[model samples]
Each structure stands twice: as C-alpha cells, then as structure tokens.
Target: MKRALTDLAVFGGPAAFLRPLLVGMPTVGDRARFLARLEWALDNEWLTNGGPLATELEGRIADITGVRYCVATCNATAALQLVLRASGVTGQVIMPSLTFAATPHSASWIGLEPVFCDVDPVTGCLDPARVAELITPATGAIVGVHLWGRAAPVTELEKLAAEHGVKLFFDAAHAFGCTSGDRPIGGFGNAEVFSFHATKTVMSFEGGAVTTDDGELAEQLVALRSFGIDRNKSVTAVGMNAKMSECSAAMGLTSLDAFGETRERNRENHALYRSELSGVPGIEVLPFDESERNNHQYVILLTDHAVTGLHRDRLQTLLQAEKVFPQLYFSPPCHLMPAYRTDPPLRLEHTERLSERVLALPTGPSVSFEDIRRVSSIIRLAAERGEQIDAMWAGAVPA
Candidate 1:
C-alpha cells in the first residue's frame, strides 16, 4: 500500500475510502438551525426544556415521521426508558442480541430482564420466531431494534405479542427513514423511539423521540419525560427531566428538511459498493440493508471466517491500512455486557454469528461513490493477497 496521503483525522487516504470509520466528518445544515435556536434561548431567559425551540422541533419531527404524536427526550435511551416506565413494564423485555450496547441497557435501567433473541442473517433485525420461543411467564414486552437500515419483522412480532398477551416496542435508532411494507417504522409497534445522535441518519446533534398513534400511551410518555409532570396537570407517578433541549430540536428541524438528499446520496454510494463487490471469494457481503438502502441506514454482513478465509479483525485492520475504518457493529452483544454479566445473552444462533461478523461501512450522505469504490478495491485486493495483508500490519510501528 502507498503512504497515506492524508490522515483519517483529515481527508483520509485510499484506505480512508476503504474503511468504514473516518476521522473528520461531514457537516449537518440542521446544526446551524440548532445554533440559531441556541442564540434565541440566550437572547431570551429560556433554556433547557421550556423554550419554544424544543416544541417546534418535536412538532416538526411528529410531522416528518408521520406519527400522530411525538415526544422528545434527552436522548433515545431516555426516550426508551420513559416509554417502558410509562407503560408500566415489569419482568423481561425480549430483544435482539446483535445490537449496540445502549439497546439492552434500557432493560436493566427499568429492572427488566433483557431476553436476547436471534436475528435473521440477511437483514440483522430480530427474528420473531426466536422471540416467540424465548417468551416466558415473566416476559412482558418485546423490544425489537431496526438493525442496519431495515425495519424488523413487525407483523410477525405483533402476532406473537398478541398471542402471548405482551407489549412490543421497537428501538428505531438506526431507522431514521425506515419503512415496513406501506407504512413508516414508528407506526408498527406498541411504541417506537428514534435516535438523533450526531452519527445517526437524521441527527439532532443529540436527541431521541418516542412516536405512537395511541393517544393514551403518548400522553403517558409526556408526563414521564418531564419529571413525570402530567402536562395535563395530573400527576400519575414520578418522572425526571428526560426532555430534549430547545437547541437540539432546532438542529433536528433543519436536518428534517434535507434528510431525503442524504439518504439518496447514500443509496447511490451503496450501489457502487455492491457492483464492485459481487461474487468475491472470501464471503458474500450482507444483503439485508442493501435491499432497503432506498430508505434507511447502510450495513454489510461479513461472510463468516470459515468461508471468508479471513477473520473480521484482520479485514478491519487491512481496510484501516487502506485508510478505511469499519466498525464491528456490535462487537459485544448487549446481553454479554458487564451490566448483565451473570445474565448471559440468550443463544440466538444467527444473532451471535452476526455480532461476530457484521461490519458497517460509512455510507452516509457525505460519502461519495468514489469513496465506496476505493473501499471495495481494497477488499478485492485483500481477497487476492489473502493472508499476506496481515504481514503488512504485523510490521507497522506503534504510533
């Protein structure tokens, strides 16, 4: 490999194009709106949760996601907590094992056990069948995350929830614009929450929201997010300040207007990656999110080590040398985290395998097709050179 023309902290190198993680990041116009809102707050005496800025952002998000009601929280984590608390959840909440750590943490926060279910290798969403099999006397709700950009199998899960008389919730953090059949994602479950962290698709710079068509449940969440203050002037229980600040909402309003362009650019970039990587020798790249790239986040399924002829860590390092930085999407499945140390993750065969092999590339609106091709070329090169790529990294100097 040639010398890195630019460090990842800057423009990145050929490796930059190859890697999933990058140092410098693209900007969000919505952020400017957030700054302006911050100015408005400063100009006035309002800050935190009381300003009009926060209200506007929530109202606008409710409009965009097509939900009848929306409530903004400090972050998606808080939003999930609010929902679970408001719903009065008790006992275990079923969810996929192959997701980010924060996902399962919510379960622990509310004193609910997180029952890890398996995933479908193709899409990486929770497997409803496995979820059904895991249902027990203590199970109260099912928390399904929209892994990658695709929506989880809502219809099946809903059926299972109904049969078992349990609630079903969807953690839609990765599904900013996700759809299921004819409707949007938030509409599918008993309740759904979205994340707007900077790295997410429709980031608020930092925020999360809960959307539901159920007017009663939506009202319950309202009280829970605002220190359990019943906005309706009736106190049902104790709640804390889980509200999104006015500034964050301002930024989100701006991103909402231009989110379409971002998703479109990413879709185009992904197509190029697919074209270049067809039929590679190591393993078949994942096709789940690929099918839904027209809408949500982008992700790749690495072929298992046995067939790919390469381990996930080795491929990651090889791509990093090319300046491409991919992440082991869920290096440690949530149930495996220290929070649940003794409560081991359930044996969802596919979810376990997926956590060990999936690697999501950078395909946000900012990434160009040129970037995609650059990354793909290095992968092809690795397949050609095989284990020889390891030699290149084994000899690198410590930085």
Candidate 2:
C-alpha cells in the first residue's frame, strides 16, 4: 500500500496507502438497537406505508423539533419536493448557491425557476441582503439552508420574506437537532425539511421529514407522502410513493433514542479540534457558539494559501497520504453545476471562493481524541511549510 501511494505521488494523484476514515459511521449501540427494532417489526409483520413505527417516529421527531406537526418521507430530497408542492409555490424560488445540489434541484423539479443567490462567506448560508436584492415580482419563495448545522439568519430572512409577501422555506438537512435560542430549527419558516441520511448526526439509514405549524399543510403533507390518499383510501391529490418505510422509521426511532450520546460525542470532537487548531497559522477553523447548543462539523477554510503553502486540495491530498480523508461539503456550489447554469451565469464570488477552500474533516461519533490530535498536527505542519514558502516568495519578489 505504501509503495503504491509513493508511486502515485511520483506520478501525481497518488493511490491512498491507508484505510480512509469516513465522515459518518453507525455505532455499535446503533446496530444493536436497529436489530431489536427489526425483530419487533418481524413479529408485527407490518412493513411499510406509514406503519406504527413510522407514526411513532413522526410524533417523536415533531416533539423533538418543537413543531406542531411532522411528516416523514423517504428522504430529505423528497421532503423538499413535498414542501414546495404543498406550499402552492410558483414562478421563481431564490436559494443559496453554496449548498448541496438538492436544494436547487427540488425547485427546478417543481417547475419553479431556481434563481441562485450568494451566501455569507462565513456562515455559507443565504445572505439576507443578497436575497432581498434578488427578489422580484416573479419570485414566489425563498429557500434558506442551515449549512453544516450552523443556523442561517432566519429572523432577518423571515422579515425580508414577510415584507415581500413571499413564502419562506428552510432546507434544514444539516440542522436536524439544531436550536435557535429556545426554538428548534423545524419550528421556523413556512416549513423546514430535515434529512436523516446515514451520514447525519441522526440516521434513519435513509429518511426525512417536513415540519410545519399549519394544520392544513400538515394534512396535505401526510396525504402527499402516501400517494395523496385520504382516510377513505381514495387518491385526493397528485402524489407519488414517497412515504417512509417501517424499517427506516425503526432506524430513525433508535437514532433519536441514541441522539444525545451521538451529539455529545460530536461536540467533544469539536472542542478537541478547537483546542488543537486554534491559532494555527494559514488555517481558519470556523467558530462555534457554545451558547447555541451545536453539534459541530469540523469545517476548516484555507483562507490564505500563500501563507499555508498547501491550498485546500493539496492539504486534502496530504491528509489522505496520512490516511486521514476529509470531505468537501459543497465543492462547486449549486450554481456551477451544468444543469443549473444560467446564460451569463450567477457570479457568486463568495460562494466560489468558499467552494475552493472549505474542507470537512472526519467527524461524527467514530472520531477519537487521538485521531483529532493526529489530524491537527498534520494540518499545523502543512501550515508551517506554507508560511515558510510565503516568506521565501516575499523575499524573492523584486522591488
């Protein structure tokens, strides 16, 4: 493996020598609980289509999110699609370019033009000012994302949406357990959709849900999820089969049961990163507000490559060489995707810059304190080399 990596390095884009650490992993407790739930399911013989487990998961998730109603779906993308359809939104929906492609794809799939807007570089969320500037008579809604579990400026964006009389949708895929003061993420906006993908802090193996305070919309969502079927078992609306299966619901139930432990572990990892990476030159570890009760993702921004001889991509390669593989959350940003590109194209300077430098380190329940120390040391060494190179270049430049 070492020889292969060395040879690859010689030719550029080396073969990875060590077993790559993944960003998300299910714990042993998670496995045991999941098996127990499956056993219960096997005994009951209820498999899918809003079964008892699915209903319980919806209720528990609703309670956890502090929302009046929650409707679970097959995945967050389906949840987003359901929300956009139920809201009766049309024309254009303004959304941040610095997000997963699903955000824009949902809007476009619903026949609404997705107008990509820039985000605040620091938060990687919709900038209220930029959103306001982009609002037009044709604009019917605004979809704001809480990137990396970091809360977007919801209050400001809500105010802006209200003033314009446009519907506000929040893509809270990364913010399942996130809270804003006393209110959780799902309690905000016209509706907030969450992801329970295997990678999230909470996993359903694969599932999602949409939360809303409106009773009518909640009913519509429930119907929408199950092929628009009403209590009479008649198709009421044009809906598809996006309902969360019993197995996924079982997984979600256990995940919620185990959420506290997972969240705390992730938070501890965040603290370790802070302690190790703080004041490290050429690398900027994003700040987390302890007051906000966050499950932090280890996202570092390579702000000045000149100072850190290794840029984000190069640093990722070096980390892989050490068997520490990090993931890039949203590399090209939504606007840069070939399907979503516009005529002149949206020149989102901040989004472009962030896509170039943002890197997500190995995180979640599986990362250990020792692993954090090793990753931090490698980053520090890379930054030191970067600083030296910067100084050398400064000296070499002619007056």
Candidate 3:
C-alpha cells in the first residue's frame, strides 16, 4: 500500500489543504432552510417582487441593518443605480479609487460622472477630508464604499456631505453585519446599497438591496425596479427589470436565521489570523477593532517592496503550486481598469501600491481557524524564502 506524502489535503488527513476553495460564508441561507422557503413560494405562487419571502426578508434585513425601509433588487449594481437615480445625481459624484468599480460604474451607468478620490492607507477607506478636497461645483454626491466589510467613518463623511450640500450614498456591498456606534451600516445617509452576492457577508444567491428612510425614494425604487410602472402601465420615468425573484428572496429568508453563527465564526477566524500573522517579516496582517469591523475578508499587505529578489505575482503562483490559493482581491486599482482609464483627479499611488500587495486568505465560513493558520504559515514561509509574488489584475468584475 502507498503512503501519503503529506497531511495537507482535506482527504489526506489534514482538516485543511493548502488551497482549499472554501465554501465562502457570504452565504444567504442553508440548502434546506432556503429550500423550505422556496416551497413556501411555490405553495403561494407569489413568485415576484413583494412576495411573502421577499417582504419578510426585507423586513428582517432592515431590522438587522437598522434602516426604516429596504428595497430588494436583482443585484447590488441595480440597487446602486436606483439610489443614484432616485437621488438626482448628475454631473460628478465623488468616490474612492481603491474600491470595486461598482460605485463608479453605477454612477456612470446612471449618467453621473465619477470623480475619483483618494483613500486612507491605514483603513483602506475613502478619507472624508480628501472627499472635501475632491468636491467641485459640479460634484453632485458622495459615494462611500464600505469595502472589505470595514465600515467607513460615515459620521465624518455625513458632516462633509452636509457641509457641501451633497448626498451621501454608501456602496455597502461588503458591509453586511458591519456597524458603527448604535446603528448598523444602513440608513445613515440618503441611501446605502447592499450586495447579497455569493461573496458577501450575506447572500440571497444573487440579489441586492437599497435601504433608506425616505418614503418617496423608496416608492420610486419600487416603481423603478418594475419597468417604471405607473397607473395603467403609463411609465413615469426610466426604470429597468431589476426585480429580485422569489427564489432569491426565499433563500434570503433562510440565510438570515443562520448568518449569526457564520458571522461569529468569521470573527473568530480573523482574530486567530490577526494574532498569528502579526509582526511577520515582509507582510502586514490586519489589526482592526472587532467591535467595529465585520471581518469579512482576512487580508494582508505583502511588503513585497521590502523583500529583495521577490515580486507579488510569483508568490501567488508558488502558492497555487502548493494548492494554497489566496486571492489578490483587487490586483489593479479600479482607476487602472480599462473602462475607467482617464486622467485622474489625482494620482492614486497608495491605492495602486495596495492593489499590488493586498492578499486575501480564506476567511469564509467554510474556512476554519486551522485553515487560516495553515495559510498564514505558508505566507510567512513564502516571504522568508523571498519568492517573487507577482501582481495580477482582477479586471472590471464588480464586487
């Protein structure tokens, strides 16, 4: 009988393999739970917008997010578009260049010019003070990205937006379960859009939502998602078929119940990685406050610049060879993407550098603390060996 060489594979005795494609927690609901809701939808035959599960899910989400109203949509991008349109954003909208392109793309899709702004290197969030500097007479609104499940300083941005007399819309795709002070990450501004993509803290299989307190805007969003239906099919304004189907909503209903435990697991795994990877040479592991962050993705900054004879991309390849696949979540800053190529409002040096260095380990629900430990150890080993970890771009794919 042949003996196995190593205890790294999931089937090979180790609980974690080198590059286990974790079942990401950003899940909406369990199979049986969501399937049960699906059965409900099937029973009622209310299979479209405002169905039982959809309404129920939206209510639960609003309760979770501390918002007065929630509008579930086909996807996060549509939620963003609806909010931007409903808010009357025209001309320029200020946004961070370090985030996913969804923020700016939603603006552009709705005919608003996205004026790129800078981010805070420490927090990887749009700096409110820089937001002030980026505002112009043409600037219509501020789109704040709560990227990587870390809540931005929304309070500061709120003050800045009010002072500038512009609206603040949060692209809160990564902000499920994230909170600030007494409120969760919704309804703090004119609107905040959430993504229930399979990769988010919460998932509805594939859906998104807009949370707001304004009834008029909420009304508009409802009308807007259903092809702008007015009395007798008289279209009031431009809208799209951005409705979340019953299947998605049913899944969401199930997701809400079990998501708390998944969230707890994520936090726990993150703490382990944070403790294990700290002070490691040539790498910068995170140290975010648990009270504030949702710890959606356990990321590190590869100080590949500090490591001689090594680049970022080669490290990824080597990790892949070892079956330990860590993600370079944002390999090229959003501004560097082909669709957004233009003269910048300012250079995004820090943003670009971060894109080259940031590495996201397996922090999903399927990934155990043991998984993080192994991944962290491999990263440290790679850094010690000075393997070239080259940079790679994840282009234009919206978060």
Candidates in order have lDDT scores of 0.73, 0.82, 0.75
Supply every candidate's count of residue pairs whose N, Cα or C atoms clash at under 3 angstroms. Answer: 14, 1, 18
Mark the regions of model 3 whose C-alpha exceeds 4 Å error after superposition. 1-19, 22-29, 231-234, 293-304, 343-346, 387-399
What TM value does model 3 have? 0.88
Ranking by lDDT: 2, 3, 1
Model 1: ten consecutive residues of lowest lDDT = 4-13
Candidate 2: pairs in clash: 309-386
User: What would the per-residue lDDT of candidate 3 be over residues 294-381, giving only the tens digit for each residue?
Assistant: 6355455455646534467755755555566677757677777888877653468667777787777667677767667766776676
Candidate number achieving the greatest lDDT relative to the actual structure: 2
Superposed on all Cα atoms, the candidates' RMSDs to the truth, in angstroms, are 4.5, 4.4, 6.4
TM per prediction: 0.87, 0.91, 0.88
Among these predictions, the greatest TM-score belongs to: 2
User: Which parts of model 2 have CA positions greater than 4 angstroms off?
Assistant: 1-19, 301-303, 387-399
Local error of candidate 3 at residue 194 (angstroms)? 0.4
The C-alpha stretches of model 1 lying farther than 4 A from their native spots are 1-27, 30-34, 232-236, 288-296, 341-346, 390-399
lDDT of 1: 0.73
Q: If candidate 2 were superposed on the true structure by all CA atoms, what would the RMSD be?
A: 4.4
